[model samples]
Target: MSIRALVYGDVDLNTVDGSAVWAQSMTRCLAAAGCEVTLLLKTRVGNERLTAPLDGAPGVTLRRPYEESLLDDLGPRGLTPEQAVALITRLDSERRFDLVVLRGRRTAAVAAHTDALAGRLWTCVTDVPQTATGLTSAVVSELTDIAVASRLLLCPTEELRGFLESSVPAACGKSVLFPPVVVPPPEGAVGPGTPRTPLRIVYTGGFAPRWNTLEMTGLPAALGRRGVPAELHVIGDGIHRDPAEWAKRMGRALEDTPDLVRHGGRPHEEALRLAAQCDVGLSWRAPEADTDLELAAKVPEFGALGLPVVLNRTPMHEELLGPDYPLYAGEDLDSVADALVLATDPQTYRSAAQRCADASGRFTLERAVERLRGHLRLALPPAPGGVAPERPLKVVIAGHDLTFFTGLAEHLMALPGLEVRLDEWEALHTHDQYRSRELAAWADVVVCEWCGPNALFYARHKRAGQRLLVRLHRFELHTEWPRKLDIEKVDAIVCTSPYYADLTRERAGWPADRVAVLPNWVDVDQLDRPKLPGAQHTLGMIGIAPSRKRIDRGLDVLAELRRRDPRYTLAVKTKQPWDYWWVWNRPEEREYYERAYRRIQRSELLADGVVFDPYGPDVAVWLRRVGFVLSTSDDESFHLAPAECAASGGIPAVLAWPGADTIYSRRWIHEDTGAMADAIHSIVTEGRFDAVRAAARDEIAAKYSLRRVRGLWTDLIISGGFPEPVRPDGTVPAIR
Candidate 1:
């Protein structure tokens, strides 16, 4: 089957810009994958003349919708939404495309309207809204709607995924395909004969508000003060202002730094060549901003050219480069200055550069395009490997959380021809039930959730004949378990989020591909119902303990709300206190647990409007009365409270857990709570209870529904060829 793709965006392949670099590399990769790619460049005024074909990218075909005269008249202001849409519609009418990939706001708007295009349609969103600007909000809303409505939405980073999922109703079940950065060999692969006069540090790429250009200029001065002989080279023109003017201002700010050489803006290859010779590359971005979510492509480009990078600590980089990458946190000048001092040391810089390069392999064009092809299969089937015939399969689920195990078992039981066994083990502090050889011999596939005892058990029991899958929930590694567990014993380690998978790979030293991501599934059909009475004023929180769950935050929100409105009541369902005591290794620590539990219990008892309930089977039914569910967690793998609450027709106001954000985002949370007080106020004042409830149900029904999740599990099991007991309907019998 010939794969034909049409990419629409403001891409100028001739220029050495970030978008251009991406377009060129992606087009090349698609071509290499035997896909015929046509790039439709949305030319702005004066930028039309900049349209030129990339040198090595022969497989890419470029076309401009508007003439050079019209584009030139528009200048840097660019095309309006209506104009861009009209142009894309015209192009769509002329050519039938198999896949239409849109970029940016205007182009996405255009592609959204092009229903005439055949095959699946996808949009690549590169921005997020942090401020309350009208245009930003409008674009965000449009993109959100597009994401919710479109066939696929591709995001470059987990941070962006979080932002999109929280803000956009459309991203609920979306597949996030991280963007790749192509690294071409440096111009001078071999070093010069003699030592260079001075160590050169380069900063290339367009100047944007998020680039924090002023900080880049100050870097040279900082390095000089640290007694390092370095020259600063500024490359790439700015989109907003002249690159030359910005360079001049930077040079002046550095007191006319003697070795500084400002080359304004050069071609991509030339800039890369210069960067390769430099000892270090500098880039900075604010984590809270939208632009930061779209990692600056330059970081990888610098790495590809063998230059050590000094960048701001953004979630995007953290996802791609891992936590150990050399990064300076915060936006303070001193932090940047300190990084500059460390970056100038050739040995240190070179080692860091090598690490960056090694990491870059994961995001290579070849890898990204291959992954994209696999994900896009959801929309378009492969010519040869269409969905295989369903068959009976044996699956085993191992976990401590009875609720999770029950939920999964119920979902699996609903599926036809699939036999799933629940492997329950007593707590490590209790009887050593996990050591039972019968349990190991009884199952074909063993699924272990959480690290500790389960990981150790897997190491002891798993052999060449057995299939072992271990799941790392939030902060499981933060404990000493990952360090102590023999990870090599497991066949596969599953994580709920790619971010966590990457984290595990780094911290646990696991193979990249071994860490598979299988997000938490929900039973959506169960949630289709009207809200229960008192749902408008009743808020619910599910979970016990405070250290990791951050239940205190939820209590704080409830306390503040109750002070303002007596009508507002909070209900909490905590696990039986004795159950925790039984599971805890140190029974003496029961005092510590009891003391903390009593405080929460006492708070609820003292508060006239608060109610605390013990965990029970009817918890789901009770959750229906909760107008909102609170997730005040410090850590989670994939918190089921918000998802369950949503299923139960409850609104969810969630804060970013320390590690949860790596898997689920604020978007998955029914309502995002950046601040506790603000969140409580909104839930009380804004009558968005219905909207939140509806949105939550819609998300669960589409992505996490048992029907949908059953198919995913069936596909995996059938593909892997697991044995199971056959039923009357030729389906797998449910193992009780």
Candidate 2:
């Protein structure tokens, strides 16, 4: 099936605005990329007013939420959440959508929070997320939430993307750049050095306070003192101010010089056509209130028409153009005069115009759209056979957090005869019913990552031809979910360890044949590393929090080991325990952590022997400094950290949890904290540490290595544990 993108625009397409043009051009280009696009708009622009850029585009459909007159005077407002959700549901019922392009801040919020659009939502934030106080306020939290909830968070500039990524690390992988999209000028557009009288200077766009349009009125008088005649061509009007008041102000300024020509708001093409005859473009802004994140589309619009732009200097400008670019100006009229003078110079104008035209290439319709298309290809890879096959198995992995399944999802993407999609619920209970029902209609196999509400959702929605599989780790079985999940609707239940498998099956009264033991896949090759020389005396643990992790136990083992050997040290790579949301909210949990903190402060572990490392990306590099990995958790399903430690040539000293033996050997599993410390000391003193580490690495490589058993997942997805279909004669079936 051809991929479909629902382009949600908040404004009337017939209106001449930057956002409106962006929405129009993107939809047209997406259509050109062979994506069937349905433009769901909230404006009054009717089918007849859909201009040349959109009307003739192939595979394009337009839909509006209200009558043409409902939002005429509202000025670029988006559909309400209810209207957007209703529209999404109506379109989704016709056919499942592969992607949803949410345009503005309000639209992104509406789409990102809507459950049906969860994993498929691509949000484009068109404005900066800052108030007068900057990003340090509560708006930061709102922006962070939007970034975290989106499958891909997009902005129009690299500067904005960098700022957002620095502010919110979770946006690192999902955020993308959607640069300004400019429509190239018509055939035989004027080049640099085109003759124009009185050095005609152009200014296009509204007379907003931040725009500083009044500054342009003085350009003509300033250049007059330098013995150069200049005229200003103002091609647009203000939105927030009365047109008569704005016109009167400009008329008064012109009465003194008569060089300012105020051409009120016109069609986009007509304005650009008028701007083409001008010698230069002027764009100035008030420095204090300006949002430097947005590169004025009017600047590039002039660049495309071969006019050198005279604009203020900002970080975004310095990034797009060289620092030494001649046309940059400050707020003072003298700076504006100097920039215009340089633009009017014969030799200087030629070079500046050429540079401006070249820079405009970055914003061309083909160039900007290609970048968006590349991100789309990464987000929605083509199905096998170069298209969706007739009987292709649609495998949907439904989960709350699938961070551990990232590797498996990559493997499944490459697996032949499968169309896989990950549906990650932002919050299980808050998931949208329409989205769940849509997944039910789309998938042949639904693999629920946790045996909580997701599993219950699939069980309740299980259809005739669809197979349901739920993977339970350790925590869910302790909850009421085990009893809540309907075992009859589920075809299979996967457990990460055999211990949990037996316990869960007995508790849920599931048949033995319906349960399977599948270990979590860890990339062994990526984890294997040479241990550092000083690492021999160091003990390490990962994820030491939530009380169940038994960080206190790890500290006790560290103190005991240090008493025996002064060289021994403990390194913990974990998120700050007190940073968890529950820490400040729950009184009992706060008390527990406060006491733990007091103990650490009083003990020598915090003084010199223990190093608390914050969580980082390169686990393999961190694992190199760990000679022995400690799993001091009170309970766990499989605990991949110890396996990771073994892969990095670190001996595992696991505190015996309920399923400890299923994951680690009995020799490594200890009954108590003191015994675990003794085992590590014995391994080191007897010179058996190296041998144990090597054997552990070998076992992990053989059993849980991603490459070794990816075929098992492929088989499970392709075959669904069903017997081969045979003819009634009891003979082998023919291959179709």
Candidate 3:
């Protein structure tokens, strides 16, 4: 799959501004690296003369403010740096970008706070504070914020990276050196000929106070004083007005300088050709600023043209040009003049060109493309099925009736490294389609609590790299949801019991390896409270609405217990039968519950012995009044009540309903009501109830406490311990 990128900056690609040139060239470089690129320019559109080269570029798309109506509302102000982020988010939501390339301090600062752009930004902040005095607390904080949100910070030289890392601790080891991507000119260099008396010195790019364009205008006169006539060609029509003096100085010089030829702004290729026609590319700047952090963009552009460039002798420049190189010049006229005089010598000129040619190889289009490609390859996990490292796994717990799964969701949420959101459905078979779709797109792992409509929705609409984990309960195995699921799209099928896991494998025809058993866990510490007085004489059951839950069996056991001891009473905690529309709607379910209630009401012994308690989340508080928790069902994936009962300082009296013997301790499971009653009586009469309670609590803590089973779920979902789909290309991209 082609990597999708969004290149954003306030740069006007219509001009030869340093940032604008960097943004455009990087876009081309990314396109060369097999990335489908969209370049979003915050400035006005109409500089086709300067931007025409990128117009026909393959896999490249350019956007401008006018076309997007960013200028219509703002008029003279145009698009704000903040609004650029709005457009980015709008574009991103339509089709997500794997990576976002951003330049400029204000743009990076703003985009850093946007949640949609976080952790995906490749922020290039070349305009950082140059000196320790300029690197104030506020500056450090701003860059640190950007670094926190960005995947990597882009730098042009080690000096810039060192400056950022040393000044702002957050920037340490978070930056990558990204030299300029130089697209060499098609035409070969034209050198000095005949006597080579008039040395041609060319200066391209923005003219500013620090850039020393005004000083460059004085070069020809300096060369004349040195008995060497020279021509200074100043290309590019734009200038940054940060310090108005330089703009005013260059303005008057452009109009008055006799030896300096002002060639108006030309297309990139034509401008490069113009610079190549000259003998030397002039990039010398004033020494008033600590602009030593970055290598000048034009130096490489000149290098690409096979021309020796005259630049300041900073360490960054020295690194680019060898220390002993002949033409290191100052901003003063004499030094520039001496460099120009040296350029007029054919043998010295050829050696400088050769040096420049060798240095230029390090910044070529091919090398830059490969560097960017490798950086992206190592930094970003592959698309279709990989996750970025260091970021929390965004998990969406989706399904209806999350009663059984909310504890697991809470456990995951308690982890500092996981982001959890609940997508509650209106019912088992219905969900908000838009919300489900958005959640599915946003989540790294989607856990459908029950393999119902929610599972079906996610499975059918699953996107690449998004894992779908559907947990199957026993009821869903009997439903049409399992049969209709696109099981191939699901990464793993979870079951609370191995029996159900195996049953799901058999019923749904799922691969045995794809299913895992992660049982329901009780918070043992939370439920291990002081049992209420006379709790030993009480029997407990939760949720008796469904007739298959075998509430009738619970009653027979309670009657048997009461026969042995009159103090024995049953407490059934759940919504009454008529409270549930699903259960009360069915004629058989209503009749079955009515009969059970009638039997309890008519029997003088059981009428007062059974108490129906209201069901709520206060199970730990209510469970104090229960002693022997009964799990008498025809079939169950896992009845959580017995585990919770054991946690609540009570012994579980579970009937051997199908797989109940395998799930619970054999000592707890009974064959019939008589055995269940006999076990409860023996514990109470022998006065070993407290001992049995402690033993049961310890057993529950070891086996089914939230603490015990949490890692299994966390590893399966968060750590992705389940089997992953092998991409059709037969590769799994490593997340570095």
Report per-prediction Cα RMSD to one decimal: 19.3, 12.4, 23.6
For all predicted structures, in order, the TM-scores are 0.52, 0.57, 0.54
lDDT (10s digit) by residue, model 1, range 256-335: 65666777656555666666666667776644452445667777776676666778775456656777776454586668
Query: Candidate 2, which ten residues in sequence have the lowest lDDT sum?
Result: 722-731
Q: Candidate 1: what lDDT?
A: 0.61
By the lDDT metric, which is better: model 1 or model 3?
Answer: 3
Candidate 3 structure quality by residue, lDDT tens digits, 505-622 = 9988988877866777777754765676799999999998688889999999888888778899999889887888998999999999889999999987798999887776556666
User: In angstroms, how far off is 6's CA in candidate 3?
Assistant: 1.0
What does the lDDT read for residue 315 in candidate 1?
47
**Which tens-of-lDDT digit does each residue in 422-525 have in candidate 2?**
77888867577788889888998998888889888888888998889888877787789979888888877888777877898888888887887667776675
Candidate 2 backbone clash number:
0
The reply for model 3, stretches above 4 Å from the true place, is 70-72, 189-195, 242-246, 383-736
Name the Cα RMSD for model 2: 12.4
Best by TM-score: 2
Instruction: Give me the displacement of residue 717 in model 2, in angstroms.
Output: 6.3
- Candidate 1, residue 341: lDDT: 70
